[model samples]
Target: MANPDFEDLVETFEFLDDWEDRYRHVIDMGKAMPPLEEALKVPATKVDGCASQVWLVPKIADNVFTFRGESDAMIVRGLIAVLSALYNDQPVSDVMKIDAAAELGRLGLNDHLSAQRSNGLRAMVERIRETAAAAA
Candidate 1:
């Protein structure tokens, strides 16, 4: 499952004039994510450090990692979607190469997010990187 969404998002973000519109687009991307089954929602998948409740589930097959995530707040959920595009459906080597912090900066999202949200976002990226490292 190779997701092509990240490049599209980057292109769209480049096209957008302001952060507000980009934020809206990010939210829309989250809204478009399919709802996870109740069975998959569990304590083990939960992502900590977020003001809002968030869950992330990672799966690996044939050396490719994919993720499923959910969050209580719309914005947080969108952030999860953004993370999915950034991290999911990739080889362990590729995932290991990503500097999640710098990549978020490239997206111009770090400056706009609240401090709490920023910490939460960083936590999420750390979790993904850890998962990738384990699988790698």
Candidate 2:
């Protein structure tokens, strides 16, 4: 399935006035993701330093980088959904061009997250960038 549109995700979050509701929405998004294939799960693809287990696999086709990710925690899975919407099916350069922190803020997610969760998110993004850089 195609990743949800970023704007649509932001709008959906906006509809939830309360943080609790928004969080549930996020978790639901995570649950909505299809499971990653077993073959793609590997140590090298795993995202380190996450509070919960997370694996990220990057694919480059026609110069665009598409990401597939999975997480053990529901909240983390939701976080992956957000990241996927931003980075999936985009060129490596385009993914690198995005200011994820600012974009998350615009989506009203940055301030709501705990420091640990924020750090994990940063780590995930950095890993993706590193993967892209290596591919480049």
Candidate 3:
């Protein structure tokens, strides 16, 4: 599936016209994520501070960095999908350089999230960056 751009997410939010619809869209996006491989499932790959169980794995292929993530909760899986849309298939440096919070704000996601969820999202991003840095 094609990754959604920041503008695409924003436009989706605008088109939805309600938080419920937006949430459903997010869940749908999460449903699209490929299942996390059994080998990649480990405590070390798990993201901290999230309300849901989230795992992230980064790999380099053909010189491009790609991330794979999973969450037991549908909403958190959707959150991973959003992050994947922005960071997957980019170089490690590019992924680290991204200002996820600001980007989410521009996508109208930051404003809608609860404080805990926002913090969890930030933690997820940080974990991804740390993984990328290690890989680099």
What TM-score does each of the candidates earn? Answer: 0.93, 0.91, 0.87
Instruction: Please give the lDDT score at residue 111 for candidate 3.
Output: 75
Report the number of the highest-TM-score candidate: 1
Clashes of each: 0, 0, 0
Model 2 weakest lDDT span, ten residues long = 1-10
Tens digits of lDDT, candidate 1, 70-126: 887899889999999888878877887877777677789988999999999988888
lDDT of 2 by residue, 33-121 (tens): 99898887889888888988899988898888888889989999999999888788876777777788877887778878888898899
Ranked by lDDT, top first: 1, 2, 3
Best-fitting candidate, scored by lDDT: 1
TM-score of 3: 0.87
Estimate every model's Cα lDDT from 0 to 1.
0.86, 0.85, 0.82
Give the CA lDDT, 0 to 100, for residue 129 in model 2.
84
lDDT of 2: 0.85
Off by over 4 Å in 3: 1-4
Off by over 4 Å in 1: 1-4
Candidate 1 or 2, higher TM-score? 1
Predicted candidate 3 versus true structure: per-residue lDDT over 22-123, tens digit per residue:
989999999998999888889988888998888998788775778889989898899998888778888766776777777777667777888888888999
